[model samples]
Target: MSDIVLLNKHQKKALVIELYNQGKTRRQIAETVHMSFKDMADIINEYTGEDKQVNKPEKSKDSRAFELFLQGKQSVEVAIELDMPADKVEELHVQYWRLSKLDNLEILYHEAEYSLSLLLRLHNILKDKRITKDKDISDLIELANWFTRS
Candidate 1:
């Protein structure tokens, strides 16, 4: 695991400007810098002198809702845990789902890679043991061969 770097307020502002100049969307910049969406909007508003009123709950609250949701807790349970309204918990869960879509894709990619590696290892073991007579092992070997093919 990589070390987590904490950014000061000034550093965050500078990074926000740099990312914005690099054509990153506000949401992207916020996620990249571990900032809240509301804070990112405020920074953009400050830089561009646009007074856009974004009404979002605190980042901690939103994160708590998301954490519970990811843990398989229902919205009502999360609300009870966080002492908030169930509707609000549901709304935060939806936002968390949207925000984590890219992360989920990366997870799926890694899972597929792991599964392929396991299949290849199993195929090699079965072939070495001369167990290809089994229909399931033969099918698995074929599938592994298909995967290894360009």
Candidate 2:
């Protein structure tokens, strides 16, 4: 492959990030972008985070979530249609975005859905005469505080 002579450092950095996100190996990126291994390593370290370097292995496109995503369905729809747990749907959502490079993160939908579900559950438990014990109340408190900012 020919060396990229006209590319600036900024352009090289962007290329590195794009290649990294596409699951290219360090050597492949360096060679493609015409950088020495040291230059490539420094760019990867300085311009990117550990999370950027991580890529889930590609799965077949036959997944229901994949089909839904291709059809432009949002997270809440995908979750409901598949009847999956929030965490699994979120995981698939993350993977889908990484591969597709689309800015389609539906965080608010998860938060609203989860919050409403939790609230309804809490309301049911509060009205239950069986939850008269302090332990159950403590568990409820813990559940209410499940997702606080660290």
Candidate 3:
């Protein structure tokens, strides 16, 4: 097998700029440029100065809610675990549940029709319930279901 030809730092920097402009992520650019992800990151940092700033990862309330949901826990459990509002937990759970279903299902065209009916039903129910409830949870659930169906 032949040895891999690596680009110099200047070339890497130029490539990183091009890739960033094209909306490719640091990791993706690193792979495409045939460099170690860390090396590519360093070059990008030198060029863009984006790495100098420290940023915290946005902790996902949805992930925590999903874990609780899998363990047979509900909104209250999620709220307690994540120290968020019960309503927020419900929102996250609905979102996570919908995404999970979409990821697992190998949906066909026919299922889309069935899914639309389900979404419309949820939408109407939520619309009606909105009159009585301050927090209309049906809307959240309906949106989630709609995305999954699509």
The candidate that wins on TM-score is: 1
Alpha-carbon runs more than 4 Å astray in model 2 = 1-5, 50-150
lDDT of 3 at 132: 40
> How do all models score by TM-score?
0.33, 0.29, 0.29
Error of 2 at 89 (Å): 56
Ranking by lDDT: 1, 2, 3
Instruction: Go through the candidates in order and give the clash count of each.
Output: 0, 0, 0
What digit string (tens of lDDT, one per residue) describes model 3 on residues 42-75?
Answer: 7767776675556657657666668778888867
Question: Can you list the residue pairs that collide in candidate 1?
Answer: none
Q: Which stretches of candidate 1 lie over 4 Å from their true place?
A: 53-150
Give lDDT per model, in order: 0.79, 0.76, 0.71
lDDT of 2 by residue, 1-150 (tens): 975378888998899889988999998998899888877877777765544345666544338797898799988888898888877877887777767765344444355665867766766877775775789889967876885633
Q: Write down the TM-score for model 3.
A: 0.29
Clashes of 1: 0
User: On residues 1-150, what C-alpha lDDT tens digit does candidate 1 reach at each position?
Assistant: 879888899999989989998999877898899889888878878998885644464568777788887888987888888999876875676676668785664454457755867767866998898877779676876998999995
Model 2: worst 10 consecutive residues (lDDT sum): 102-111
Top lDDT prediction, candidate number: 1
Candidate closer to the true structure by lDDT (higher is better), 1 or 2 = 1
